[model samples]
Target: MAHFNKAFQFKTRSIIVLLTVFGFQLTAQNWDVPADKKAKNSYIKFDKTTASEGEGIYTKNCASCHGNPSKGNVLKSLKPTPPDLASSGTQKLTDGELFYILNTGRGLMPSFKDVLSESDRWKVIAYVRSFNKSYVQVLSNTDPTKSDKVKVTMVYNHETNTVRVQVVAKEQNTSLPLKDAEVLLFAKRYFGKLPIEKGLKTDESGVANFVYPKDLPGNKLGEVELLVKVNDEVYGEVESSTKLKIGIPTDKPGLTQQRAIWGVLAKAPYWIIALYLLGIATFGVFVLYLVKNLFDFWKKGQQ
Candidate 1:
């Protein structure tokens, strides 16, 4: 009886531990978004027009998993699965809080600070909040705090085959340079932007240098768009872009790409080609035989 009691106690403890872990996982997702000290209420008013504009941004950047507005369906294969932004799980977050999340993504979500321009991200927030109709008027009435935006210039050096980046943060009201800001560089690819080099902090002169690939793969035209961005830990994000000429696209298929299952007809196995030819020949013969039989029947009727 004692041995059975000991086993029962062990099983009970195991079940309790499992339940605790499961409960924690469920609870954590609710408050998983980190606080953004820079986050503040949006000044931009929410309206059907603003939300419609935001819908364009959201569909392109967010709809893959969250749910496509066009299709009205979402991908559910992810482990935790992306939440429906229109639902209470996301609608409950304030406009500022939602903006912060878009700026700084958590877990499987990606930060759109660099992917999207500052105004576009705000536009997306407007579209998302439109799902709840209560805050439309309140958002328009609230005053917004203005923050300093950054300006970045990129010059590609042909002699050294490197990119020279200059980042200057200045208040929109005052054009004077703000020093010691962090800047990031990104090269646009077919699917998305690929970040190159570590984030650099500007010097006293507000200049930072980076080495970009001299032969980065690109489209058939060999053009790669380079982006320089700065996301302030305290303020808003700003960015600039310049197109650079890179190496030609590497999409030209090799000889190895010419064979097997999905290969061109010329690259197909001789036997398969022969079978294809035989099928055509057999079809031709079948038609000819039927024609011959019909002619013979006509002749016999005439006789």
Candidate 2:
């Protein structure tokens, strides 16, 4: 009787522990999303438009591999079955993880880095989560409606050695400044790694400024390909073929002048002119020495 009671107590404790763990996992999964489920009085709004847009995007782009979301045909063919979007697996993933998978692609899924814009990718992810309760819960937790509408502008100036970046939030038909939006600027060079620069948020006008180094070692100032991102979403990118002319340092004016003079001299017959002057100077010195020797011999004979 005692042994049976001990075994029963052990089993009960084990069951409790398992239940607690499962509950924790569920809560954790739920917490990974933004906290706006009903779209009522929310900062970020989601509706049929976004979901339809996402469905269209997915059909055009993702359906080739993932298959029809409703049927899960293509997904089933894989060795390990792809998680059904309409099932519990969809809710099991965090919004960030889903975004990462959609954008970066894992295993057989191809990366959509070039194919989809960051915002569109997020929208599709939001749509995929709408299929099930778990996904809906996750989306509700990771609300896209909370995103501040931001406008981004990129300006590259070769003369000033600067890449001026601007970001603004659009609210109520008026543009308000977004302060402290992290800006990442990168310029790809021909021969080496891209130079990266980071800038802080704007003041009243929502502008961030990053100056390109006056002299990027081993890189000529020429057309540089640039990539810019704000809040992890790509803002805008531009490839400028602007040339950055080499500037002489203030302390090296003499060297600059010497270089200028030598450049002009190089264009002319400098070697021939130098040789001719050297020959004339040699002849003049020889003639003076010979005349002095002759005068000295005459004086000695007189003595």
Candidate 3:
């Protein structure tokens, strides 16, 4: 009886631990996307050509973690093993859901929203869907050509230290305001674009306002290039760039202006240049002296 009771207790503990771990895994994998994002569809059609292009893109960007589709060679070292794209579980997810996951990554997954264009992201989805033989794509009703009709203008407010972005779509003879659209503003920098603030949604009047930083540095002329990206369900994605004279005027000296070891030869320190030339001259003189000595020794041998 004692042995039976001990075995029962051990089994209970084991079951409880397994349940706890399984519950945690379920919670981690649950990506609760909004209703709008879940319903969003791709403007690009899924075809063989686009799927082939997407395969190349996936090999470069996603294969490192997810591995090739249908292959069980995923990197299992990760805490939550990435699912194979060809697996039934992955194929069950809606196209919009897959897009949302790519845009808003969790844990070890990095967001590709900034890295890949909207067209490219859709192409990647097309490639993944290719693995599902029975999968049928539902194209978005949004007209991608309307993206060219979109116009975005940004204006800075001096007193409030804010930038106002207005979006409008022109069709026929009427200009319609684009309301409730997603807008992202960025400032161009030497290395990469810097986000001005958190992404904002346009209001009823098709305007989104962002607070600009007062301490942000600009060129000597205080000119900063601003880029705005607008995403609307009806118009797809549109981007516009403009230069503004709002940042702090910075006139920092160029890196190559001052003498540095990493600088160009012309920008190298005078002492370093002098030393290099002196070393070359000294080597030439030693070679000439050795040649003269050899010549004198030959003359003595002849004598």
Best by TM-score: 3
Please give the distance, in angstroms, between residue 62's alpha carbon in candidate 1 and its true position after superposition.
Answer: 1.5
Task: Score candidate 3 by TM-score against the native.
Answer: 0.60
For candidate 1, what is the TM-score?
0.45
Better model by TM-score: candidate 2 vs candidate 3? 3
The residue pairs that clash in candidate 1, if any, are none
**lDDT tens digits, residues 40-85, model 2?**
1211223577777888898898777667675766655654445556
Q: Which model scores highest in lDDT?
A: 3
Off by over 4 Å in 3: 1-39, 46-82, 100-120, 130-138, 254-303
Lowest summed lDDT window (length 10), candidate 2: 36-45
> What TM-score does structure 2 among the candidates reach?
0.43
Off by over 4 Å in 1: 26-28, 32-39, 68-72, 137-303
Encode model 1's per-residue lDDT on 1-303: one tens digit a residue.
999999999999999999998876554375444443233556567778888999998888899888953234667776466777877767777766777778787767788888997668878888878777565433333222333355677787777777777766466576544355567899976467889888877677777778777667765567678888865444445678988775566665544456555568878777888899999999999999999999999999999
Each prediction's RMSD over C-alphas, in Å, is: 9.4, 21.8, 7.6
lDDT of 3 by residue, 227-296 (tens): 9999898898899999999988999765667998777899898899999999999999999999999999
Residue 166 error for model 1, in Å? 20
